[model samples]
Target: MKRTTSSKRCNYVLEKLKLHYSGTSYCNCFEPPWLCPEVEECVWKPESNKSKQFTNAVNTWIDLSKKTNNLFIKKQLYEWLDMNHANILAVDRGLYPVERFFPLEKKGIFNTFLGRIIMEILPPCKNTKGKNKILHLLSKACPKRCQIRNLKEIVLQYATEDDQTYLFLLEVMKKSLLGKYNHCKVQLQFEGRHVFYQMFSYQISQKSFFLKWFENGNHQIFLFFCLKEYLCDAVRQVKTVYDYIEKHWKWSIFDKQVVKSMDNCRKILNTISEREYNLLHVSDWISSIESFLLQVSKQHIKLFRTTNAMGYISKLKVNLNKYIISEDLNVDIRQDVSRFLWEITQRTTDKNVFYYALEVLGLEREVVEKVKNEIFCALDYKMLSPNDLFTLKEFCRVIELHKSTYNFVLPKHYYDKQVLSLKKRENKNNQAIGYICFICNDIKFFLTKLSDSSRHSNKLARGSLRVVVDNDISCCHENNLKFVCGKKPERHVKNSKKKWKNDKKALTRKLLKEKQRNFLSKQCIQTPLQEIDLLGHAIQFNNKMIMLCSSCGNVCMLDPESFKYSVNINCKVCHVSPRDICIKCNTETTCNKILVYNQRRTKFHKAPMCNNCTNVYAQKQPVVI
Candidate 1:
């Protein structure tokens, strides 16, 4: 042992040599097959060596760049996978080559490029560990320092030409990292890629993870993504239509129409997208596609119907109201029916249904005319009420009303505010051009005079009031011309002989107070025979005393003695008229019987007049026999 070169290699190097030797057993024809370790022993790794297989897989994909044909194939393959060409070459050249991370005592695989490649190599089968294995490989792909931009590059490199693979990768990422990190930001290379990433629930993940994705954006991307697996072909078709609409449709005019029309398409997408695991039956997909197309067709019909109606009306150069209203239009409907229709129109949400109901009742013309008049009155006065505008909107949905007719009409307060704004703008322009309000000019002249009067009072005179040169006629006069009073504190006075002070003055004040009390007491005196009238007050009209009724504006002569004695004067015309006149014939009539108007004893006339005049007052008041 002293003379011999007794050297020992590290256990790791020894194991590695053994592994390499076992792998090359087929290369050595002279070697005994039984002497070589099994294939499992050669490739299989312990928990301590989890990244060994992961590194081999990544190296297998990464080493392809050594050959030109394989490199070209790899480039084109990744390009079709919705990956940037430059990114592939950079990773292939080891400029940010596939990285492997392993925890000190954890049992997880590497997150290298071929770790993702192994997913396609080992597709899902009856094996339960398939998902766990896929996730185990992808768990550590992103390092602690990695952000969304780099994450996009790393994750997208693993994408394949197949859409299902990208979707599956997204699913795996969503399940694994979604809990740890809310979402990842993925920027597409180009438009029309049929990739919708915003719609995914990445927002529901951890704020720290999402913030990292959201904050670091080296690229621009659209929001709202979708991963359509079921009815994928139908979704593509819908996407084509959506692109056309988005590009060509006049958004201002057709925004609501487009949104309404595509509701069914959105529902279809949502239904298909909910199935994370691809185990749906063919019948299910077919049924979903059929309903989706059916809904789309229905919405299409609705949109076409509305647009065609609009176009026809536009070409005719007439309004919906003009079409409905006519000189010869007969509105001979029942009063109750008209009332009912008005109530229904106010309450009805669906304008089309309301219009249809109006058409069925043959009252569309009357209703349209009424609504048109209300809208005109509201708009002309700029009424602050939204009731009429709401009615117009509800009616417009059924009749395809033009925006020009109703858009200019604002609520009363808003209209006034805008008018005031315009006036203020005009005033500003006037001020800028050296024009000023007359009141402001007058104040300026007065201030100059005051300043000239006292040289030292110039600043004080100028500081008295702020002058705004608004030339608007509606500007408040009081606002511009205000008087500022100086504050003066009252001086305290003390009298030593309080009892001997001003005896004559006190006696005069007491006599005045007694006279005032006597005058009011005499005016307030009332007799027992005099009836009280609560609704009327005495007034001197045309130099004569008269009792004025507040409720009905009737006046009656009051006797001087009654006026002095009565606390409240009663109107003879309203309370007890001297005579009654026939209402229909306008002639004096005699009373036959009293006509009761209602259960309450409140009659049309307050005085005992001819009951035949009941028809005159109550307009044919029926007598209760």
Candidate 2:
């Protein structure tokens, strides 16, 4: 069984070698059986003197040193050197034996060279385990008293005012540790003191070791008592320093001082709870200042020139408004206070400022009303230009300070009446003389009649005459017809049959004629007039049916005397006198003269007088003529 196991192991080794050598070797077949020995014998046996002599002879012929030029061969040689050194180290440590078959001189040289390479590649002691050992040794060798003294020196060196104060408190606490305050014994009192002292002491010790020391040992006890008495005193000092820098320092020194003061405040506050000491008062002031700053930022215009103290005052007013009632607060001081508030309100972008203002107003109605009234009154008198109107409108919308109750000063009707008067003036400028007509109530009607001189007279003339009525039909006396032809003779039928037939034909023709006559009569009916009926009126005078005025040349079918007459007398030639006149000849006379004018008068007379002319001469001309 052992032989079988040995055989398997030998085969496995040979397989691994073959796989590795495949890329480098020229041969394909395994070595011959006679040359390949048993695995154990090949692994265990050293080369005999004769075999070594033979290997030396073969090596001398092959020039094996030439193959050492390859990088892979050099790497393999170095790996072999490393493996050999590792084996030597393992054996020196009693972990394994050194191989005897390997040449002693070559092994020694490889091991030494590898050892030197490792030592060169290794990191320095500062980064290695050597650093830990050095720290361990120093810790063990240092005395506790010496360490405490060193810690004290270190702490004093780095002690800030707050840190020194804290350190003094810690030392005072240590006095209790020495049993000075044993009467104040309580549960965990020792533990609490130890914890408190250790906490501050360690920090101070670390700072002292690394930073400069301050001389404050003389008053250490006194400082401790002051801190204990007024636990927030250091915080107050920090606040004072912060306020000083904020008010007096520029940006260059502001941040540095702020950081230093804040750190001191933080250290002091962290040492005590709020109940023990309200050190957060400084923080509260800081927060208030921050809030003020935020508000001031919103008021970019007016508040831009504000000093820090002014800004702080403004912020204080804002905060007061946030908390205090205006009536409850001093009213005499409110104006100044509100000015401060407004400055901050305008400067800040904070919505909370407005909200705070609202809250204040809610608490103080009279003050709010006064402020609102003042603002609205100012807005009213402010001669807001067109550009400013829109902004003012928006401001009013946002603030809603007042409701506008009145608009333009003038009454609406007054303006309307003025506009109508202007329109009348414009119309007068464009009006013509004959544009208006009292009779027709139309400008165009009068203007059209005035455009023609003949139509003008016709338009003005009124005719009146005798209209003869025979039975119910009215006709002109001149139109009464005198029969020029006698009535035609009526014919009668002689024979009964011939008479009947002829009568029938005559009746038929008569019926047809009656139908056509009736049709024509229906077509002759005129559309109805509202107030006048022309049902039975007919007249004729001279060549046409006409009427004449009895008293005036104003021709009309109805009597001019029956109705009032007014003529639009434009020209004498075309004028028809409202009393009596010959319209065409521009002569005024009695109606009788116009009706019967003498065409031939005395030829040698001063005037040849027609009937109308003679009457006009009698009335209008001189009797001498």
Candidate 3:
């Protein structure tokens, strides 16, 4: 009968053959004979079968010897073994060589080396076959079990290398792993090689599938731990790279692709937990970078027009304010950030620059004099006229709101002073005229009337207890007697009846003469009264109107008796009266009292008291006295 052997039996035979050649043997003495299928197969092959058996035995021995010999090959074929063979070898020899066959699976060489170093320092299993063995073991081990010290040591070892290529590879590996993990704990030492390595590593590592796991998988816990490890490893390196770029790279160096890539990276970083992703103090580093970029942007603003540059600057200002005011950052760092923003404002010409500077000053409570001076010094006053600059109403509003903090000096004040100086120069060319009284307060109208009368050849008269003036005075009512005078009083009247008789005769003659003169003057010069709107209020030159408040000491022009007593009247203080007397004091001295009114006037009338009196009365208590 033909003999058959199971694959496991065949494998057992082959393993035994290898041991036997090396002077070792396995004794399965107590096992059943049926299990020894190789022995049965050997017995079944006889004669011609004997020749085949000898050949088969020799070939199996040779194959086992060759397998042993491959372990020491200079270019070990084990590194190139297929997955199935590698898995089998991993089970037999352990995971060390197996990882070599799948080097890309373990992050990268840098990550693998780091994994091995960790294993060496706090090894999962002490006797690893090679560096790759430790990596393979770490991959299978729980992420929480991974020691932070070992990760830090691996990063430091490779990061310490001055070689650009080695550093680049190290960074690439770190970035690749960071894509998958959010909270890595590696500390990258800053150097030129390291920065370049990090940038390039980020460029390449974004494409890794391990990175996709964090993005695509539902294993939130696993994803978080992986991300933690990666961020811990990459944050310091990323900051170093950005710092170098900010200082050394020009704006032109940032093409759309690079900027887009940077934005994408930022977005991805933002998506991760801030606590975990901040292992390298990346927020501080990014703030520094933003500050540098803001400076560059401000310096290059001349390359763009005012409007376009303003748009760009607005975004920078927003980012800058966010950084400066972020409570998560240190106070000193925020201060520095604020200073940098101020510097950016100084270099910019856009009007919004000052607005942003104002906001910064408001936020930081900074003295913005330097920024203001710089802006004014660099501005093209010729290009932008005073009026044009003033047209930025929003800027003016901001200045008004924060002028104290920003130390904003009003431009209008300076302009007015300049204009006054010019007016003085013009006045020097003209001769002095008669003094015109400056009416500051209560007697403005009377002073204006006196000045007008003096300009004409007007005569003066006396009425009741007051003196009045007119052109060619007539109808004087002094001591209840009337008299007409073409000139100043020469003598006093003794009899009241005779004074009235003489005044009537003189006034009649004066009126006839004045009418003739007025008609003649009317043809040459229009009457000043023609411009006055007489329909509203009747002008009364002489009336004994008593006023409770000195401010309301003018005659009531409205005829209270002509219309009903409800007729509205404006008082001397220009207040509208709802009632006949002062609404505030409720004093009935005269209807000429000042009245208060608003737009909805025929509405409830407010009291006619001054603001000061009202305030005092509101706070005062009635005295027993």
Candidate 4:
């Protein structure tokens, strides 16, 4: 067993080295693994012998090395040097090794939470950059009597106001906040010391300052930065859960594929313990982030606008080597790369319920493609993004003054937006057969699960399922259909009116019908859909019996006008609140989902906050729903 393991390690290292050395003279960021830093210190350490240990391997490595004739590679490993000293020894390879840059206190532990917090936030820190700089400041700048609890205050105390170190430390804090909860912020108060002597002796969170950010606080510094990161992460998780539930609700009502996937997710959520869920969540996030980083590495961009592209290129190469992207079905590499390069100047769902449900239930589709389309919709909706604006401005600038004929002009609709984007025009096109009829394309699958009878034809309790679009030959094909309801709305109808009149007569009629039917309060009024049905009184003569709108998820209704069979389907499903009703005032809020419940069909509420609460809590204090 030991020999076999040793052989595998040797082969792995050899393969990496082969790839590293095989690349061109111009490209050589990929290199050998690091040897033990204390190899010289330990008496038990074997002599630096490379050639004799792997005589056969060194010949191949040297041959590959000579082909490159790269100066960087030459400097690292000279021809005259002993092969043993040049080659890496994989003596202590582990899945994740524990290494620390900062020394332990006399008691053999990280003395304060500050150090540990810093270490935890900035990951893969084989280099002591964070620890070295932090330690250097803390060593002399920190007061012997009392250390400031705040990282910002501590920096200000030790360094001048204009020092760049403050910026660097801030960057570190920002990095630490990555993949953390949005609601993790905490506020700390210490009076009379004037930043110099203030220590994090008294800490308060935005939710409850009395409640410490971490489970434990052994530091004098308040570690408010740390708490803030965790809070952001918490808020993010809560929001994700809410979005998942909302999506599930929609799937249950409309899409058969999504319904089955959501059901599986529900079963998993119900069966699993909290510990398993936490593990799954962590796994999901890690995979998402790593995948993102790997995807970013594949593209070439005007990187960070540094004067010396060489250094940036070298760093980019190193990062690429570290986060290598292999062939994957689950990941749409092109889309991920495009998003990192062109679109994602803002946040989108990293791995939402849609993807997660499919992933856990072993259902396969182009899930990444679905996510990409969603991201595209989000980016286009904000209308001429800064990036888009800049590109347009720069293009025009060049055309006018620079005498460059790139001949790249913005699309006509890009400026006027005369043509509706797919997200906006989701309701009118369904060239496919059942799509025109407002039913699932895979009706056969649903039929297999349920007995074929007239009673169960409209399977859902309230409304029958149907495609969201109809009679647009331009969008009949699958390719056209996929993109159809994905366009951004031309303009937000801020005060969109309800179809019915606001008169006493209308109200009385609505109330009478509401009493006749066992109507739910928050439910969409049946009057509009009923009106749509009433429009086409028995006039369906073999075009296809239609029931729902697949494009905009509208069902059994006259979309734009009442009593008109020719009315083009207008999807209002996009306008419905994402069940984010504020708990305090029952108003729908934006992505505010701190509270969660297991039961289905309960109107999920949102949390509200005032400006004052925001200062006390981070970023609009998310009230518990």
lDDT of each residue in 1-625, candidate 3, tens digit only = 1233333433454344334434333122111121211332221111233233222332232233234543222112211121123322233233322222222222334443443333342222343333443243233222223233344334334334324323343344344322222222111111111232333334434434322332343222222223233323432235554354335432123222223333344443433323333244434233333343333333221111212223332333333323322312222212233334434544665765665555543422222333344343223323432322222222332232232122122244333433343244343212111111111001112211111122221111111111122343243233332211112222243553455566887755454444433322322121111111111123232221111111122222332221233223323232323233434455432212133344444443444443334454555532111
- Score residue 337 of candidate 2 by CA lDDT: 32
Model 1, range 214-315, lDDT digits (tens) per residue?
A: 335311110101111111111123455435444543222233332332333444444454342133232222234344444433432111111122443232
Candidate 1 Cα RMSD after full superposition onto the native fold (Å): 37.1
lDDT of 4 by residue, 476-507 (tens): 44333231111111212333225344777765
**What shift in Å separates residue 545 of candidate 3 from its native position after superposition?**
78
Candidate 1 TM-score, C-alpha based: 0.17
RMSD of each: 37.1, 55.8, 36.9, 28.7
lDDT of candidate model 4 versus the reference: 0.28
Q: Candidate 4's error at 254, in angstroms? A: 42
lDDT of 3 at 70: 39
Off by over 4 Å in 2: 1-188, 198-203, 209-381, 384-625
Model 2 C-alpha lDDT per residue in residues 299-356, reported as the tens digit of each score: 2222111122333223332333322221122212222333333444446657556445
Task: Please list the residue runs of candidate 4 whose C-alpha ends up more than 4 Å from where it truly belongs after superposition.
Answer: 1-625
Model 4 earns a TM-score of 0.14
Top of the candidates by TM-score = 1
Least accurate stretch of 10 residues (summed lDDT) in model 3?
435-444
Ranked candidates (TM-score, high to low): 1, 3, 4, 2
